[model samples]
Target: MRLYAIGDIHGQLDKLLEAHDRIQTEAGHDAVIAHVGDLIDRGPDSRGVVEHLMRGRDAGRNWIVVRGNHDRFLPAFLERPDWIDPGLSSGQHWIDHPGLGAAQTLASYGVDPGLDREALLREVRRAVPPDHARFLATLPLWHLHPLALVVHAGIRPGVGLLDQAEQDLVWIRQGFLDSDADFGPLVVHGHTALDSAAHHGNRLNLDGGAGYGRPLCAAVIEPRGAHLLTGKGRVPLVPEMTG
Candidate 1:
């Protein structure tokens, strides 16, 4: 069976749909699709993206969505808008940082971002479908396969897979990005953006800056190796360093 791993979607439903179509056309019948998450925030149509995935899953499509740092912030903000913390506080961090698309997401859900926090939260709760919330709540942080370890962000180096901290798995960068240690499996992840996908000998990054107005990417992994599914066709993954 082929394994198609998609990068951080960041609410770009159009790109997500395009990537899905490419994957469906390229992957074998028994393929499984894994999304290295960030499914919401930082783009137009966050609600649409979540709804699309939920529908696909309900239709029996094999999909695995790993949690991301942005994703982690979502539940907290949704559950308790009054709780003020970095990333989840006052919705300002979201506006200033990667959550620039937060307003857009709210708009998609038919919630007015201009409303006061309490009222906005209430509107969100009323507008966002229950299934979408459940889907977000159930996202896994990692998916391990015989040949691949799929994650939203790179994993901490020198730590056993089972012992790695959840935060590092979804939020780490420098340490994990700099490490060259064998990680037991090909670490397929997305968090850091790049002009293109980065394929180190030990791991592969597929971010491709979809949140920053670039195309979302997907890697099709088979027993033999992996290839990037593209509009042109399947492009073989080659080793390269990003920094």
Candidate 2:
């Protein structure tokens, strides 16, 4: 069974579908497609993206969806409009923060984020479907495969997978990125976007910053190695080639 990991989608539904088409063509319909989360925000069609994935799951497609920090924004804010994640984009509200892209997310649901706080929250609550809210709120932080661990962001160094904090699983950076520690299975994540996929030996980052107008990336992972699934076909993904 081949495992393909897709990077942060950030509401890029077209790219997500295109990647799915390529995966089906290259690896067959039975291949497992692991979404590295951040499926919403920063793009034009958050609602469509969520609906498409939901429908796919309903049809029993081989898909794995993990939670990303941006995935938490709408649900958290809908619960408490004043909520702010105390991470990198601390202080600013989720919708107001350029990096978070909640405005675009709300817009996808036909809600105007420019409305007053109370009105905005009310409009969003009315716009978003109950199932969509439930889907975002209930997403897991990680999915452990025999060959690799899929997560929205890299795990914390020096901590066991069971002991990793939820925030670190979705929003961490500082300690995890620079470390050489091995967590048994390869850590596959997408939070920190790079221009291309990265193979750091111990971990793999597949985010190509689709939110920043770059391409969405996906990698084909084998038991021993991996390759970037491209339009032209597989490209060997190695530390030297990535850097």
**Considering every candidate listed, which one attains the maximal lDDT?**
2
lDDT of 2 by residue, 1-243 (tens): 468999999999999899999999987887899999999999889999999999989999989999998899889888887888887555898877877788899999999889988899889989999899999889889999878999999898889889999999998888888887767888899999999888988889989999888999989999769999899999998864222
Model 1: per-residue lDDT, tens digit, 115-191? Answer: 87668778888888777777787788899977799998888888888898887888788788888788888999998
Weakest 10 consecutive residues, lDDT, candidate 2?
A: 234-243
Per-candidate TM-scores read: 0.90, 0.96
Q: Residue 40 in candidate 2 has what lDDT? A: 94
TM-score of 2: 0.96
Best candidate per TM-score, number?
A: 2
What residue pairs clash in candidate 1, if any at all? Answer: none
Task: Name the Cα RMSD for model 2.
Answer: 1.5
Query: Local error of candidate 1 at 8, Å?
Result: 0.7
Q: Which residues of candidate 2, in runs, are more than 4 Å off?
A: 240-243
Q: Worst ten-residue run, lDDT, model 1?
A: 82-91
lDDT of 1: 0.81
Clashes of each: 0, 0
